[model samples]
Target chain A: MRIRCPLCGDRDSREFTCMGHETYMHRPAGEGWGPAWDSYLHLRDNPAGVTRDLWYHGAGCTAWLLVERDTTTHDILRVELASDAKRGNA
Target chain B: MVKLVEKTPAEGLLPLEINGISLTELVPAAITSLMPFDGQEAAASALLSSLLGMECPHPNRSTGRDGARAVWVGRGQIFVVGKAVDASVARHAALTDQSDAWAVFSLQGHGVEDVLARLTPLDLNRAVFKRGHAARSLLGHMSAVILRTGENTFEIMVFRSMARTAVHELETAMRAVAARDALR
Candidate 1:
């Protein structure tokens, strides 16, 4: 599998380290929130097929990547930098 | 700060020749100095880019705990490569050569991977190993970091004592491959 970086071009999948899903939770502003914490820590989907994941290019630029990958085959399908994805490049 | 030991051939390998450079240990401290820049990943990228004169195409970041970064120096300990500039030295976060350590062995030939696969579990497919991708894994029951220095060459780093074991395993594997190829 290969990952294409906006600045560095495409590189082998081994150069990237999988950091899991990109979904994150915002902290509650005030008051009791027991369930929120529990859900944040434990309730995460463990899908088997094409999944979106957070990967880091620890050998290149330290860019955070959101990649679509086939978990069963470890084949990466699409990759976008976190900075670009946040800018709505979807 | 850790003391640096320059390993000699006789102390580690049998009938050692002046062929490879080995460090006494993986001594994490040697590369720690390169971690203090504002964006450590950028700094690492720049260092390799400037040194190698090629764009380093891997994502890099400081490991954060001890100003370490997970560099692809091949297999094991997630090689933390760092450098220190004058300004950052005062922070007690800089890594001098004393802080980080490495042992470089130059292994070249047609079947280098065939020999390496015997000691490491990594999938060394050109499509997989490529260049600039390093992994932390075991080599012959010892911790090691393997770096692909060239298309047909690799620089394997391990603790000082494991150096002998590593060389033995590598030579044995290489000879085995040669023998097998001869039969074929």
Candidate 2:
């Protein structure tokens, strides 16, 4: 599989590490430890298609990527800098 | 000033100069890692350009005269190749010294691409990855900055701790390529 890196262009999948879903990134920050921490750590839904995911470009660029991909076809729909995407959303 | 000695990053194996390729260990006089401060990319680029006497290279590119060169490492980051300049030593940037953080190796000669192909998944086509281009890619199981300095010359910079392993992997590929060529 090939992933289009925002900085390095399309590169092979070997250079990247999929860091799970974007849900973890957007977990609510609150006053309690139990519920928030549990949801953050354990309650992750594994969707089948068009999922927003996080991947680390470990070997190239070394940037975190927010990737929208189709889990069924292993097709990448879109990729953006995680920092930029997160900030814009925030 | 304390005197400095040069040492090659080898996995205790002797350096090779066979099958039209030679692996030479290099010690650049300086290796400063420059990252532009947020919103200071233009200013950072200008400073490096003035110092380098050329436009600062953009992503996956490199520019400079032999002794003074700049290789782009990633977005907002560059490694100035010259005398060791301190982090923040240049204006409009956050800097850090990486002179000792990496082990530099020069892989030169014909059939170089064959060896690299055995390791990295990236395209090493002369048309695509021409001289003066750099890429951070996997070299064996470790990550490395692969810079093409000449038509048949490449510089591989890997972390110092992984230097021994990187050299071993390259040496193995070199030998394999050589053997294959001999058969051909």
Candidate 3:
């Protein structure tokens, strides 16, 4: 697939890095350490279908992105910043 | 040929281009922008290692500044600036330059940090993302590389297809800040 960048113009997808599924779980600061640590380190929901993800332009300026794409066909629906999207909204 | 101004002052926007590339010469060094590794940290690191002909460690993070004057940014990411980048180095990497698929933009000015904060989740606090540090993070859904070129300027690299979208987002934020400043 052809990937695009804001500054460098259109480059091949190889120049970009794929950061899978943008979903993240922030550990509750007040909670006990064990559960939070486990969730932070080992828990991840690998689902199919359309999902949001993160990517980095390793060869470029190294920008991170939040991308919504189809896991089945690798079709990208949308891309944005993780911070721009409210937490848990993905 | 059109005459390109090396340094031109825009009312609300800072000149971010340096000889056409989104880079600038800076002192003390800083990480103006970043690209999030997400989950491909390992793969990226390995690729860099092969290209650099050195053991880049797992999930490499590069600092923008050289030794002593260096600072560290996020995990599993590297900062490219100064001698770190040769401009032509991209040709050496395994990745193909689909330059047509991406667009490059430069960011400068005192408010550059504030503009980045609106689009990114990573802390832009100088104490955290100080000079010589670089991180990999997301910016408004586009995969990008944010390089700190100076204290007030940054080099933002994004895909060409998303150039207009990213620029619009940046300009909108910048204009809002300028409007707020005007009120003050």
How many clashes (backbone N, Cα, C below 3 Å) per candidate?
Answer: 28, 2, 69
Q: Is candidate 2 or candidate 3 better by DockQ?
A: 2
Predicted complex 3: DockQ: 0.04
Residue-level lDDT for B144 in candidate 3:
64
Across A54-88, the per-residue lDDT of candidate 1 in tens digits comes to 88866544677778888899887888877678778
Clashing pairs in 2: B87-B95, B87-B96
Between candidates 1 and 3, the one scoring higher on lDDT is 1
Candidate 1 scores a chain A TM-score of 0.72
Local accuracy of candidate 1 as per-residue lDDT tens digits, B27-86: 243443233343455554455445433322343111222223335432111234433333
Candidate 2 predicts chain B with a TM-score of 0.89
Stronger candidate by lDDT (2 vs 3): 2
- Tell me which of candidates 1 and 3 scores higher on DockQ: 1
Candidate 2 Cα outliers beyond 4 Å, as residue runs? A33-38, B1-14, B86-90
Q: Could you give the CAPRI-style class of model 1?
A: incorrect
Best model number under TM-score:
2
Docking class of 3: incorrect
lDDT of each residue in B1-184, candidate 3, tens digit only? 9997543112123333422223222221222212324555445445444544332322213332232111122333333322232233333322222323334455767767877887765566776655434444456776665645467756565554666567667776677666667797
